[model samples]
Target: MTDLRHRLDAFVKLGDFFKEYCKYAKNQTQIDDNQHAWLKKFDEILALAGHKNGWFTPENILFSLESWAELLTPSKLESWLMAYEVDKNKPKSVALIMAGNIPLVGFHDFLSTLITGNRAIVKLSSNDQVLLPFVAQYLIEMEPSFKDKISFADGKLEDFDAVIATGSDNTSRYFEHYFGKKPNIIRKNRNSAAVLSGNETKEELTALGEDIFRYYGLGCRSVSKLFVPKDFNFDALFKAVYPYNTIIEHHKYANNYDYNKAVYLMSLFKILENGFLMLKEDNNYASPIATVFYEFYDSMEDLKIRLSQEQDKIQCIVSKGFIADEIPFGQTQKPSLNDYADNIDTVDFLLKT
Candidate 1:
């Protein structure tokens, strides 16, 4: 078997560990003495991560882990990679500069680098510094061959042949300036949006709430804008999303909501809010935290064309049969391994490099 096969099995084993660990954390399962050590270590890691970054709530951290665990199964990994010509590539030092907006946000690039016979030199975001290294250590332990395949960058990134960097629009310019000479994929800021027709059922609208509120709307895949029909009544949306009302209890989220709401009020901008979430009419895609920007559309065809033209600014569209390749509501966070970010195939890019 190729070393890639061993890497695949190692990831599968790590997935199993994550699944079991989540079960144990939730008290759905118990661990014996042999497993207690690992459980304790992970417990410490999750706690420290939450402590370091207030946005990294324990629930959100576990959610991210469980989401990745579900995707790293044997069938899922093999099926996603089969499309790429991975075996023909020579090893290159791939520098991965990750963004910290969401937990494990840059993991796909790291995984792509290693799974395609490349070495990874990762520079983690300060906001999310701890989790990926723990994951890497597990992978290395699972298959000793991986020890040489992955390494973390400390101060300066050097001797890398290719790059995959994620940052805001401003930082992306710097990434391009520094790494333009190399084979690179430098991603800038992008946000997701929902196209809502007035005819949506309560269930679908409720599901849309997940697309809006998960990770408190920090993830690129989180829906931050809405394109609604003219004169759309938001009573249904407010009511359907009421279950997530407790989100305001988080101090950090509440602070953002309070601050943004105050600024809008002082500026005399018309707004509607449900105490926990606010909606403002605007054309921008990237809304501030605790708020969603929306615009009314008179024609679906025109709206589709507009979205197509602005595809670069969108990570994914959350809707129901609203457009081809529409992501079902509530599933934006549950992306398959094949759902490449920014519609760029990282695995293919690495293999070609």
Candidate 2:
């Protein structure tokens, strides 16, 4: 088989292995001593990731892994790559500065670099230090050819042709200053929002709760704000999202809920609370943890115009037939392989570089 095909096969094998670890219980027989050892290590990592970083809850990490497992199928990978003419000649080194806000957030960029036959020099965020390296080892074990192509940076990132960095608005300035000279994709803070027309069913709104509560609303794809009609009643929304009230049981999330609610109350801000989540009437997209900002919209056309004007500040728009590019209620976090972050085609960028 050709080298590219071999690499794709290795990723498929990694996906299959990941499926076995998606659950708390083991269902598959051991493949080999090395595989068994890796599975044991994976179990330990899954158990300790939350202890290492409270944000990296086992459910969220496994959700990420399961999403990747579903996306890494041979057919899906082939379809995602079919649009681009991958150039294997003279592979360039691509530096990746990953964000630690969510689990395995940088895997897509790393996958793009390697799938396009480029060397990947990853600078991992301290918050997400463990999982990717473990996956990298699995990949190398599956295909020895990748051994020389992937490297992690300890300090300065040097001798790279292009860069991809994900950070907050503040750190983006630093990325631009340092990596600006090179070809790069520097992503800053962006949040997702949901649009409600007051006609959504209880099931849809409940699913929308998954979009809001998943990852503790820490991921850029998590819905931090809502756009509802002026006459929209939030009673149904409150009822539908009640199932996720259990999220407040998490200590870190509960702390944020208590703290933000107290601050809003002290400021006398008119906010709606359902014990676990606070809904404040604000125009901002980036809301604090355990809080969701909401805005009232007058006209669909005007709202569309506003969203278009603020496209740079937004990520995914969760809606049901409200907008053309609206992501379904709960699928923001389950993006397909081609659902490139920031709507910038990472594969196309890599192919050009």
Candidate 3:
């Protein structure tokens, strides 16, 4: 335990290393020749990670990584370490079943295990196998010890001290049936949403474009549904978001939007009430594709009732008047260094194990 604590303290310095790494990462044009080589590798991995047509642009990855570094403040890291009690050093292994819905979804599990001083056996999703290793490769250059903490595994989950698994609802059943006996942070489908008081101006509404299209609306934290007052005007909202139509040019994204738009149009066989697609709300938070689906409410009480009914399906809700302060939306799944996933503090979870 004493030796591990010293290693953990040394590992903590990597946060400082990442801070510098991010500085090198930020200036795309200014990056030197050697830096460009690594950035090119990252770009390749991004392409392999289901982000065609600059979806995983080097600039965006750098920006997101910078934001991640900023969130890993000294106080924040101290709190995380305290939560895990690195000195106590309860040696445990965590099996992380990664998700590929968005770029770097699996990295949070990696961050959790590393900061908590737990050995992680990662099960990489086929769709995201490239990005995680690429990031880890650079981190290992910063500190070779990281190599001892992370291992890439193929299709086997045994001798684990605990598990953290993320999957669709169907796969969740399988995870639970197979892995429930162990201490686990198992999760099912979740979507992010926002509520409107109809008071937003063009600027604020435009930021909603970030909330919706930042990752092309593929993220669990992406705003899927919006709650609006019964007489809410869609004109202003649509106009604010029109600039993001560039997203429609990406072939894969366009395919999702076009295909789902076709299904929605065919199913409704009518123009939407406000010209936005409306599909029958289901028990699912994930919509079929290509459509922004939402429900209308006449009163705040009604909105709360609706939210309570759908709470299990929701991940985060962004609202002007109806939302509580605890759940932040734009920052969903791109959680703060302290912001735990599925409301479980990973450091705490690991320490308890």
Judged by TM-score, which candidate is best?
1
lDDT of 2 by residue, 1-353 (tens): 87789889989998888887764334545455656777788988766667789989878888899899999899999998888878444689999999999999999999989988899999999999889998999999999999999999999999999999999999999999999999999999999999999999999999999999999999999999999999998989999999998898899999999999889999999999999999999989999999999999989899999999999999999999989889998899999999889999998888886
Q: Better model by TM-score, 2 or 3? A: 2
Against the reference, the lDDT scores of all candidates come to 0.92, 0.91, 0.68
Judged by lDDT, which candidate is best? 1
- By summed lDDT, the worst window of 10 consecutive residues in model 3 runs over 270-279
Arranged by lDDT, best first: 1, 2, 3
Screening candidate 3 with a backbone cut-off below 3 angstroms (N, C-alpha, C), the clashing residue pairs are: 257-290
Worst 10 residues of 2 by lDDT: 23-32
Can you write out model 3's per-residue Cα lDDT over 206-233, one digit (the tens) per residue?
7777777766677777777777777887
For candidate 3, the lDDT comes to 0.68
lDDT per residue (tens digit) for residues 1-353 in model 1: 88889989998988888898999999999796776888889999989898899999888888988998998899999999889878888899999999998888888888888888889999999999999999998888889988888999989999899999999999999999999999999999999999998889988989999999999999999999999998798998999999999999999999999999999999999999999999999999999999999999999999999999999999999988888889998999999998999999898888887
Q: Which has the higher lDDT value, candidate number 2 or candidate number 3?
A: 2
Q: After superposition, how far is residue 198 of candidate 2 from its true place, in Å?
A: 0.3
Pairwise TM-score winner, candidates 1 and 3? 1
Q: Model 1 segments beyond 4 Å from truth?
A: none
RMSD of candidate 1 to true structure, Å: 0.8
- List runs of model 3 lying over 4 Å from the truth: 1-44, 47-60, 82-84, 271-284, 326-334
